[model samples]
Target: MHYQITLAREVFCEGVGLHSGKPATVKILPAPENTGIVFIRTDLTDRPRIEAVAENVTTTLRATTISKGNIRIFTIEHLLSALHVYGVDNCYIEVNGEEPPVQDGCSAYFFAVLQKAGKKIQNKFRKEVVIDKIYRIDDGERFIIALPYDKFRISFTSLNEHPLIGTQYADFIVTEDVYAKDIAPARTIAYEKEIKHLQDMGLGLGGSLENVIVYNDAGWINKLRFNDELVRHKILDVIGDLRLTGGIVKGHFIAVKSGHQLNTELAKEIRQGGC
Candidate 1:
C-alpha cells in the first residue's frame, strides 16, 4: 500500500516572485505524517502558518494563495504541482515574502531540490479522494469536469489569443517520470500584450523575456519546447490547483479555458461531501 512521505532534509533556494517582483527565499522542510502542506511566513511581523488547502485560497488573480488572515504566498502552482506528482503527502514550507520565487518559471527547480533533499516514507497510508461521479462547473467560456478514473489524468484545451499560441490541447497522466520530464520544465508563458496589461495592474512586475515565453504577432521571441506548450502549462496549472483536495486524487479531469477559479470551485464542490 502507498504511504505518506516527506523530505528527508531541509532544502533552500531563492528567486524572484512572478507577481510581486520581490526577491524571496524558501526553505522546504519535512513535516510529520498527516501535517499536510503548510506555509510559514518567516518575514512577517507575526510568523503565520498558512495551510495549503482550497478553503485557504485567498486570491487567484494571476496565481496567488493566501490564508484566512490574509497571509499569502504567491506563484506556488509549480511547486505544488511537483509535490502532487511526486506523491509527497506533507511538507513545511517557510518563505521570506508574500510569494514563492519563480525560479525559471517552472517546477524544474523545485524538482531538483526534492531530488537533492531526498524523501522519507511515513507509516500512514496515503489518503486519496476517488471520484465517484462526474462533477462539473462552468463560467462563460471556461469550464472543468472530473470523472472517475484509477489514475490521475488531465486534458486541457486552450484558446490563446496570441498568434504564437492559437488553439492547442495537451494530455498527461500524473506520474513522476511524466511530470518531471514532460511538464515540470515547461515554462510559464504570457502574451506580450498580457504582460503590459498585467504590469499596468501592478502585477507580473518581475516578468521578463527570460522568465516566460513572450509571444507576439511575429511568434515567440524564444524557442518553445512543445508546439502546444500553452495547453501543457494549463494542464500543469490544473494539476496543482486540484491538489487543493489536500490529498492524492484518483480521477480524470477535462478542462477548457479553465483557470484557478474553476479549479478550486470544483474542489470546493467535492469537499461539500457531495457526489
Candidate 2:
C-alpha cells in the first residue's frame, strides 16, 4: 500500500563540486509518478537526461557517476543518500555542471533542502525491491551482503591503519530522522598524505577542511561530528549507492570497507535478479 512520493514543489541550491572544483547550480523538481530520480544536464545544448539507476552507472572512481552516452554526472552519492532516506521516489535533478554541489561533503544540507520542499504522495504504489534471501558481493579486501529484513538497515565496519581511525563499527535502521541526526552530518574524509596524489589524479580539487575531514599521523585536522563518523559515513554512502536500484530496497545491508563499486554492483545484481 506504499505510495510513490515526490517533492511538493521545486527547490534549488548552488555550490562547488567536490572533485570538479567548479561552481554548479541544481534544481530539484517534482516529477510524475514512476519517473524515478532523474538528472538533466541543463548546461548542454541537447539537455540530455540520465536516470539515476544501476545500469546507468558509468564509473565509481572516487564517487558514483551515472552517464548516458557522452553526458555524465559524478559525486551524486551525498544528494542521493538524502533522497533515499526521505523516500523521494520521483524527482528531476537539473544541474548545470558535471556534478552536484558538495555541500559540506555530507547529506545534511541536501536533507535540509528536502525538508524545505516537503513531500507529496502520488497515486501510484511505490516500486519496492524486497530482499527474499541473502545476497553477497565480495572483493578480496572488501565485501557487502544484503539479508532479508522487515526494515531497511545497515551494519558497517570500517578498518583503517591510522591510529585515530583504526577500526569503527555502527548499525542503524535507515529512517529519515535517524539519518538527519546521525548520518547526514558525517563529512567525507581523506588522509593528508593522499591529498597530493588525489589532486595529481585530477580529483578532490574543490575539497577543503570546510567540506572534508582531513587527518594525518598526528590526529584529525578538524573536530568530528561523531566519534565514529567514518563508519557512519560509509553507511550513508551505501544507502545512496543502493538507491540506484531504481526502487526502495527492503533489507539489511552488512558491509566491511565497501565503497561505491561494490555498493552499485549489489544494486545491479538485485535489479537484474528481479529481486
Candidate 3:
C-alpha cells in the first residue's frame, strides 16, 4: 500500500517574497496523519491557519494565494510543488510573514530542503484521486483537461504573443526524482513590457534577474536554464495548484495556454466529481 508521508523533522529557509518584497522564513514541520498541509500565519496577531486547498484559494494573480478571514499567504505555488513531489501529505508550513521566500523563483531550493529533512512514513494510506472519466475546464482561449490514467501525468502547451516565447511544450510523468530534476529548476518568468506595470501595481517588488526570468524582444535577459523553461514552469504550477485534491493525482492532465485560474477550476471540478 502507498502510505502517507511527512517530513522526518522540521526544516527552515528564508528569502525574499516575490510580491511583498519582504524577508520571511518558512518552517516545514511534520504533522500527524490526515493533518494535510496547513499554513500558519505567525505574522498575524492570532496566528490564523489556512489549509492549502482550492476552496481556500483567494487570488490567482501572478501567483496563487490562499486566505482565511484576514490572513493570506502569497506566491505559494513553488513551495507546494516541491511538497507535492515529496508526497508530503501531513505537514505544517509556518510563515512568519505574508509570503514564503521566493527561492530562485523555482522549486529547486525547496526540493533540496526536503531532501535534508528526509521523509517519515505514516501508517495511514495515501489519499489518491483516480480519475475514471474526462474532466475539463475551458475558457475562450485556454483549456485544461484531466483524462483517466492509472498514475499522475501532465502535458502542457504554452503559447504567448512574444516571438521569443510563442510556443513551447512539456510532458512528464509525476515522480519525486523527475520533478526535482526537470520541473524544480524551471523559474517563474515575465516579459520586458510587464515589469513596469507590475511594479506600479505593487507586485513583483523583489523580482530581479536573480529570481525571475525576464523575456525581451531579443531573447531571455539572462542565460537559459531550459530551452522550454516557460512550459515546464507551467507544469510545475499545475502540479502545485492541484495539491488541493490530497496530493496523489491518478490522471493525465492536458493544459493549453492555461494559467492558475483554469488549473484551479479543473482541480475543483475533479474534486467535485469525486476525483
Error of 1 at 126 (Å): 1.5
Sequence-dependent TM-score of model 2: 0.99
lDDT on C-alpha atoms for all candidate structures: 0.84, 0.94, 0.89
Q: Can you give the lDDT of residue 222 in candidate 2?
A: 92
Error of 3 at 191 (Å): 0.8
Q: Report residue 266 deviation for candidate 1 (angstroms).
A: 1.4
Return the clash pairs for model 1, or none.
Answer: 74-99
Q: What tens digits encode model 3's per-residue C-alpha lDDT throughout 7-94?
A: 9999999999999889989999999998999999888788889998888888999998999887789889899888988889899999
Which digits, one per residue and each the tens of the lDDT, describe model 2 over residues 156-218?
Answer: 999998888999999999888899899999999999999999999989999999999999989
Q: Native-vs-model 1 lDDT?
A: 0.84
RMSD per prediction, one decimal?
A: 1.4, 0.7, 1.0
What is candidate 1's lDDT per residue for 221-257, written digit by digit as tens? 8888877777777888887887788887889999999
Evaluate residue 56 in candidate 1 and report its C-alpha lDDT on the 0 to 100 scale.
81
Clashing pairs in 2: none
Most accurate candidate by TM-score:
2
Model 3 poorest 10 in a row by lDDT: 242-251
Steric overlap count per candidate: 1, 0, 0
